[model samples]
Target: MAIGPTIGTGLFIGAGQALAVGGPASLLLSYIILSILTLAMTTSMAEVSTHLPSQHGTLVTNGYMYMSKSFAFASAYLRWYTLALFVPYEITSAMVNLGLWKPGSTIAIRLAIITTIVVGCNFLPERLFKSSERLFTAIKIGTMATLFVLSLALGLGGVDAQPPWGFKYWKHPGAMNEYLVRGVWGQVLAFLQCLFDGSIAFAFAPELIVHHAEMPASLMPASVGEAAILSASIPGIVKSDVAQTAFPYILSSLAMGVMAPFNDTRLTNNGTGSGSSPYLIGLRDAKLQIVPTIAMVAILLSAVASGRSFLYLSSRTLCAMSELGHAPSAFSTRNRGNVPYLAVVASALFSSLAFVSVKIPSTIMNTYLLRLVTSACFISSLVSCATYIRFNRRLRAKGMAKRYSSSLQPFATYFGMVISTLLLLGSGLWVAPNGNLTGSRAIRLIVSYVNIGVFSLLFLVHLFKDFVSVAEVDKQMDLGGRSYGNRAGPREPRTQKMHPHRGGVYAIPEASGASDLRVRQTMFTEP
Candidate 1:
């Protein structure tokens, strides 16, 4: 749930953009398409989690046996580092939104502020730390629900029935084929945005849960699932009609216009992320009298939630890498708070470059574009899924003692890999063909090459340190629980038998490969 759902969901914001690009009619089509795609990806993720779930989710242990721990560490490092690029950007966005610090503040002063807050949080007891975070999450959710309810109210009695506030814009929409590419591209980008949003927020949550003193034994195999659930909660908390704005795709519907403004009582523009994406813009266009304070708070909260999450994730990855022997030994040592002081310091130093670039965000169309939060993450996701498929396939083929495997062996793995690759490829091809001023294709080329390139270089340099054969890499995977490898093949008509209980909780040992799990020993450990 974390990576799949928790990733920075650009969906609501993306939906608005889809309406603009694909028009109202096609917007619905795009949502249907992407939702299916998302479901498929989630299934692949679920299958993997059912087997080799770990704190890093699918990224950590899927290929540990096939690749060296160093390889796993490298994948973890690059994804974390790439994702880390956004933390400073999120902070900068919120800081700017708050209008708290003066624009002319000295660099040292800003750094000191960031350092102080981060260090202060480290001093709090664990319970206080989490409670505070959950508080923000709750506030964000409340604000979102309030916005939807109010938007609906305004939208209800032709609320404030104003000019440019009806469904006229959508009624003039074109054929789906006309805006198909635009719709597809726009929504795809939105999905990518959503992925980054959710992924960044919860990527390290499993690691966070793992450190807790009393994690549920069931949660041990659910670290990854937990992340997905949290991610899904955003959409879950808000009804789909409201949440759909997170992606916003209505051609000529009543929703075509109408957005609440800065004041509490007026309707204006619905801000879409794209040209027409600013929710504020929608509120304004509706001529609603929304106060500006609402926008500022939303912006600040976005920065706080998104920024802090990414920073913590980056630090965790650094620590994980150090533990796995991928980076300098200094990172392995944790401080009194179990914080990886050296790794945190080192990562903060590297992530600081974002400060320089983000400050000069005039280099791009908007401050947000500079984040590049999702560029490399999708690539890493594809790699992680593929590695699992590959590792597990070889195991099943040899008739080895399969501990925890998926229902269809590596097919699910292949499915995820192919789809993720296709999405990335589609984006890549789009960027490659139509170069932007920044030439994001060039940036992608650089990021991927550096990973593939540097890893190759590093591997060559330290070839003698640890040589892993395909066979050895195949052996290290431990699907501690929930193995479905031996299940009957999918029926022509697949059926799910979910016998639910009160409070929406149902429990049982439903997996096929129970032999690999030791219930008495490791069952009740932390997630």
Candidate 2:
């Protein structure tokens, strides 16, 4: 389930750009660092969610539960738009894969076709959606496995008369490329750029995984035991097997580094389809035919599938926000299949942004969208880390027994917080006075940091409107425990309750005099 939405055009196609700018060494190193950060963030979330799982999933709802309403409101919108923008990012990627990288009616037609299919799938009954997701997830795993094997074979001289090329490209390109400036600082910048680029692939992956695990049992796929295991033993499974859990991502990164040299012009070539993929470039260089086209087709399908998944996630996030009064309440309405059709339509509208590529170059458009989404991802990560810290402190103070515990606690979350901040701050450094800054460069600079401005705007606006003093918020955090509401005075301790549908135990604050319905209603309702 994690791999379903996690692996997308970012790895298959966008990695080419990273290779071009940072070379193989930086690409590999950046991915490793990202893996570590992903694990840290994932385990921290798992620890929190497993202790007091929520029906609304872990992102902004957790912020509301453990942090402040303003943070939650800001992050809810931030996450909603982040996932919504991803629809176009993936759609634009599909356009690139279809060789329609230019502006025209052709791009428009293909955009409409892909958007229809993606949006249409979300309106399906819940069962059909889950089934389609599983099918596409299987295809993604198969494609990754095939690419890994092919990359390994190519590196070992499996091609018809080609000699073994193990590590040759790394040595020739000297493993590190200078960027912006020249010298050690340039290499540092190159590595940082790689981190920023690579982050797009892993963005919000942990949240997706936790969200899937938190899904009602009826909505989960039958074959996905990992979700069940996550519900039962998230801390143990994530803490002990983080490396194993991350193996596919790590292996895919290594496979890309081995498939082609970073200096290959094809890696940066703004040409059609296969030309933009380092893996496909390697296959073409081997004098092979048909296979590259086949691989491109697989990648196109993967992009479409990823777009569909992100659409579902974004819509659900919007629906959750609506339930909390952070968005229009109409979004909370459901159709016959229990799907939030209004939220789906609202989120799917952003897919039209993919048409922006019709005017701008697809590659450039992809990068801009990537930067926008990546910045939002950094903010989400920062918020999650902060929520985890406070939640952990609360648990410790109460001497509550945790369903999941990690040795990396607090430390892992702290590390994640620092890395997220550095990446967010450095994301737009490319426009820094390396040379003359043109109008286009100025636009790029604004696009890079625009999300940060938007997040601050949302937070301040909500902060003023919410108007709760810090002392009151802290007091609520202390007394409210697992619930988030405006209720005052001492309350009874939280009591364990069995979830009727999920068959798992959950905690709810014991109401001193409130009715059961009121207690349940106010659990996730805003103050």
Which candidate leads in lDDT? 2
Write model 2 residue lDDT over 275-329, tens digit each, in one string.
3777888887877778888888898899999999899989998997887666889
Error of 1 at 220 (Å): 6.2
Give the per-residue lDDT digits (tens) of candidate 1, residues 1-527: 22221222232232343344334445444444444334334444444443333444445444443455455545655666664665555544444333322245464465457545654553444456556766665665554555555455545544466533344334433323132245566545544433332232222332222212111322333223553344333222222322232232222122433342112111102221222223444555555665334744564554556555556667667776556445678877876666676766665654455355334421222223432444455566565666656555665777754333335435645665665565444443323333233435566455333445544554454444444443343344234422245334342322222211001112233376322211121122112
* Candidate no. 2 TM-score: 0.83
Q: Which candidate has the top score in TM-score? A: 2
Q: Which ten residues in a row have the lowest lDDT in candidate 1?
A: 497-506
Measured against the true structure, the TM-scores of the candidates, in listed sequence, are: 0.62, 0.83
What is candidate 2's local distance difference test score?
0.76
The lDDT of each candidate is 0.42, 0.76
